[model samples]
Target: MSQDRTGAGLGVDRQREDCEALAARNGWQVVETYSDNDVSAYSGKLRKGYRRMLADLDEGRATIVIAWHTDRLHRSPTELEEYINLCEQRGVTTQTVQAGALDLATPGGRLVARMLGNVARHESEHKGERVARARMQKAKAGEWGGGIRPFGWGVPTGETTKKVDRRTGEETEVPVLDMDKGVPEEFAAIDTGHDILLAGGSLNSWVKWLADKGITSTQGNPIGTTEARDILLRPRNAGIAVYKGEEVGRGNWEAAVSEPKHRAVVAILKDPSRRTTPGSEPKWFGSLIYRCGRPGCTAYAYVTQSGGRRYPSYRCQTNHGGGRHAQKLDDYVQDVIVERLSRNDAQDLLLPGPGDVDVAALQAESEAIRRRLTDLAGLFGAGQITMAQFTEGSDTARAQLEGVNKQLGRAATQDPLVPLVGAPDVRKAWDAMELSQQRSVLRELLEVTLLPPRQGRMPDGGYFDYDAIQFRWLRGPEPYYAK
Candidate 1:
């Protein structure tokens, strides 16, 4: 069996022809042909044709096996021993076009075959070492390792030229990866995905958006939620080089996302609390988003239709005896968002002025803090630091990062309502946004707290008390939702 296609895209056809001619010349009646093209025996990847040939021998269908070379027929010495055992059981001998015969019938012949296989195994090991070294050097130099095309990267358009081997005077082909180039569509998709994540959009929502935009993965299949998150979080998107699962350095290719955005997106995607339902969409505005203001509890509240309530109420999930009318709460929040966003002063109130925080400085600080956290974790993982030390170090680093992220957000990355700050028809624009986006806006601008029920019953016999639903402005102008 042969491995890999030729420069002309022909796979093992030449080797098969030579083998067939050798069989014909020897007057050997070939029962069946076995060819595993574009496959490698040295690498231990499954060779379908080779396995089938062994099966034929075991079942007494064929008595002799013929191939291109002994190295192609047998892999390591261990694999050769197994082949020899099977051959003796089946009373079979092997013939090769180059190495002549592999006589498993006698002891001396077996010794010679075993020695040759050991030699080949040694060569394969040395070759693997050299290849690994070369790949690591390439990665250090910011070159892409050849493989299936990575999403959000350009398709390779260049190939390696033939080189002459020094010892054998044979021409060999090398594969070259031209992934340093840029694809506009893919880069745009990466940017859009990062933006969606930063704006509090769910991973599932981004995947749906990918399908709606007809953007499949590099393999041309619909991107899954996990794959989408992985692609967006890949360090390559920020032009960071990686070798053997470790970041090496910067890549030669242009970054699809800013470094700060890349780090922030990574944090967002790794958040345990983030919603990850692939196709499910949020229905209510404040479900599980508004905090329970039950005096002492701070757990998120969910809308409940049970408990004999006529309407769904955003009830506390921690068995806290409190809930507010979901409809009335959502309506009040919606009006607040629409009115504030429609004002002429919304731009000055919502967005940063010219003398705002320094974006570059915060970005540098964020990177340094992340690096410290990574090193600290590595120390803890290596048993060089105590759990208390790691926890303290990690918490401090993360707290610093959190502050930097906030400043970075104010600098311009986190606000999704920049487009609506001074729009001519903010109400129309707000109404046009999807429910998830509206919730994101609400989450950004206001923090809703469902307070516990009052002692006396309402005069109108309603459970939702306007005074009980506390709305605190998190950003922009404060709306008059307070008592």
Candidate 2:
């Protein structure tokens, strides 16, 4: 006995009863029973009971096969052909409650089974098409597609499903989607990832941080680099609906991140220049964050040989004069950033985000500027204004439009200093960060320019001059050290 799914299709229990009744009417003794409940014959999914039954027939344990109908036993034409061949070898006479006895020992019975299999396959195909169309419609309207609940957002209200235990034949009730209940922590985690990426941090660093936080994917698997990246890059996170693997339109659910942030992240991820080199991640905190201050030189400081000294050193990549002990330099940079983060106005060092700027207003202004330029063009074409007047008006409108556009662009591209904005123990937080993250933070806040070595040496090793290593603030006014 077999049953594909509930509703429209008979339950496996009913099918089993009917088969038993038919067996009793024929005075046939029931030897063993096999049922693949809730498993579709046409889905090509593995059916353990079906396989065991076939083995029993081949071993001569059973000389006959009984089912509710031929279609239930086999839906695929290919599967039917295989079953027919196996039955012919065992001379297994088939019995069904609704359909009459099928003798596969002859060509006629095999032909009938094959024909029924084709009809069952066609019906299943049509059903699949209908279900797919319904899913597409739901997605276009931004409705949940009815499956496991998404990570941050809730599913459609009151969605539950019955999960069957293939081994014990037990039914477990499970809620699939509950759109009213959202996971606040997961939503914040996604925003953290977006901020990290915009700050020039790697997805691998985010994965490590997530692991340390004891958080996994919604599916309960360890979130790797790829999964972490995919979760943040999902269109649904931005309230965009996707169907059949392509975005359809806006979703009904609230967006987790701003549209500008999402678009910026997407551009960064999809850029052709993104590095895919394995093990190419930066090992030094100040690898490329510090630059050579030699005259007319634009080389970044990098790790170099230290002449058998235990400590590692950094030198100008272009072989300019400036170099420093790597560990000491990294520590000094970390101290500066930690001090800045510990300040009361640390958050002020970040670029403006969606909360600071009215993105919609900027967008509207940009559109209005564009419309004015169009009107100016129309005025010129209709001979309403002289050429000189037209040129002046068009230029002015275009300039205004450019400024508005720049504001709109900045609205989407916020500063990547979210992690260190407010920390109780700023030094501890800095120490906990990955090298890549530390480098990104340094690059975001200030520039470290490694100047040339001292002109005259006094001690065994020339003393390093702190003033020679110039600092320049990027987000705010330069401090004493920066000046």
Candidate 3:
């Protein structure tokens, strides 16, 4: 039995450790330990140790693979299937501390193994969906969702008082109070605790202060700079929760500091120069797109500093500094490129061709799904079906309706005319979209690259080129743009 402790979170690690301890008590010999860090389970792109373990298995190195659970092995269903096939070929047995043994040799065993694997995969996906939904709800409600607690705030609890000590190390039970009122209350107060601490001094100083007072997180780690910064910046401590990168409503926790305090701290942290201190030069187009054009300069084109002035420059980080080149930014550069690429002629290049979708059929399908949903609702309201039956039918109909709606939305948005003919409106819509949506659109439209600036003069004695630009029609470039 072995464990793959790759990319397991802190909570997962504790669970795995407990499982391992239990397995040890049962006298199961832990044969080998395979650990991979910061590896994505979603892609399963052959982490160093996992790849070696596969090779070892093929070479008859180990017969049994042990993990705390099936998910600890592989999160993706495709990867799980591939691993199961490998185990079967090698006549290897897998023993999970929680799910027990999964043998693939026998027909029944194989079925059970696949089912268990699928269950684990389904649970992972469902967990992600649940989290996303929760975050969306929180965001819509304008509450702060999960992240590190800020400096001045403490975790709100049901308890009225907590043990506290002054800077002099004198300990006493301090009464917690509601932020709006100055009077001490019999309940734990919630506020952005970490932000209050950061606003007072440097994160390093705060860490030392907490350590000197013997304060530690629930994990027993002394507060560090990273923790301190995380606490200050996290929206959760500001009486909001965030789930899956979206802000949600404030939690039921008591306030340690007011919302205004957290907002001020966040405003300062978001400004890179202020956060970094010593005020660096402005990065006007820091995350903006650049394409590479140099013959050997495969590096992405980006803005660079020259003579105390910022210019759109392309430098091959892979090559020596001599490979650097510059492109002038004129009033019409971005507008011209955007206009040209967004022209009617270029619409086909940006969007899928007619053969990619069937407009008439899609509309008919959408209408049919909507009708079915209406019928289901009518049946429920007419008392023709039981509530349970109506709910089931309505849910199925609604899901199908949602699917069709999503397909129609995608087609409408991706239609060539939508961007080319309605350029102004499209631009307005793009601006209105959230940051995440903007990122999605940019990825969809551009196969960007950075190229060395053009040196030759044009017929009009004007040399115009871009440090980086998108290869407009290309799906992706070879090797350089591997997904």
Candidate 4:
């Protein structure tokens, strides 16, 4: 076990040479070599090479195990105990090139190994604490502590530059910096994305334009709509320092976009009331919900403007026909839905049907599925599983987990209509409900349809009649005409 996880870029080759020479001096034929690159022994992360070497020892493939140092092999007492047990089960011995010999066959040798493992564990933990403290101090000072290079910033560079020694008159090596050229483009892209968003440009259009202009993400891939949106949403892009998710203070870099613009974009994305268009509802829920009911016209309506006034009306964008005022359609359908749900028979529809359901068991199964997905990701990281297998396994596990969760959410919801239906003032109870709540109840019961406007002078609620709207009830009854 010639494990050298770090400092490998500098002297891993040298370490291997040393191990081979030591084996030669001992007249031992080095049957095999095992190494884990950039892996940590004490971090509880899976080390594939280390696991393979252990498997070999257990299966009688190899009886002797050698390492660069004790810490390279085991820094955790729990892991050491398991290894010691395995060594005892099979007649095995351990040795290190640096620390000389370890006779694990004897009790004294086992005692020494335990002591060394404890010391190694202590050192690893102490080093982690010191590093964390140092990082916190740097963050508080607003100095860049160096992480994944920010999109609009330069990558850190280091070189051995000559620095003159004052007394000896000799030159010494000093590190220097050189920045990448894409930083300016990154800054420019932030401004472009901000302008595009405010001007009501589509995210897909902006993403395509950025790709055409050779603007890419920090990973060098053509930026996606979500990534472009994230760049604009980052408060750090506007020169604000954040720690643990909250803005701590001003940053040390120049502002990419004004603070106002950054906040505006965030607000627009996060607002619950915000729709696809600035002033209206999302297309999926607007008049499109009552899709154009004209004979042989299968297209949904898209909102359009005329004579400098916006109409919340549905007209087929594809066929460009079957337009109607959305308000009249919604009012006719929603009122009928409220009246239907107020009936006593609706209670059974809202209530969960009789079935053998164990909430705790379902919850446990969901949690187990989630853990399996995590294990699949770990296998992908260790290269034990292909990306295709991981993706297929993960998606299947997620879907099962989602189904379980939906069952749980449904089981947990109290029937809001129960008390409303029982109340004397049912209409008042319906009126008091929030618009979102009202919409949710309506959606649970019916699917609505809107007919084309009649060719005549406008009626009290425009040329469209109340009969233009239709509802296909999902529960309690068949299609209910509003009349």
Cα lDDT of model 2 by residue, 1-483, tens digit: 334543333477788889999999898989999978777888899889989999898999988788999877988887787888888788888988877888787778777777777888898899889989899789867888876567787654567888766556578887766653457778888888887777677888788778888888788889987778788878788776777665556778878887667767776677677776666677888886688898898989888766675667888887655447787777777777788778888877877555676778865665566557657767988999889998898789778855654554456664556767787787877777667667767877888888876665535565545566788777765453532
Comparing 2 and 4 on TM-score, the stronger one: 2
Backbone clashes in model 2, listed as residue pairs: 155-179
Cα-lDDT of candidate 4: 0.66
Worst 10 residues of 4 by lDDT: 1-10
Per-prediction TM-score, please? Answer: 0.73, 0.65, 0.33, 0.55
The CA lDDT of each predicted structure is 0.77, 0.76, 0.52, 0.66
lDDT score, candidate 2: 0.76
Clashing pairs in 4: none
Task: Identify the candidate with maximal lDDT.
Answer: 1
Tens digits of per-residue lDDT for model 1, 128-222:
89989899789868888877779877654567767555335478875554588767788888888888877767777788888999999877999
lDDT of 4 by residue, 283-372 (tens): 433444556677887766666654354575656757566446666556666677667767667565555632555666875676577568
In candidate 4 the C-alpha lDDT for residue 2 amounts to 26
* Regions more than 4 Å wrong, model 3: 1-29, 34-52, 97-100, 106-108, 150-483
Where does model 4 exceed 4 Å of error? Answer: 1-10, 155-182, 199-202, 244-246, 272-452, 455-483
Ranking by TM-score: 1, 2, 4, 3
In candidate 3, how many Å is residue 429 off?
45
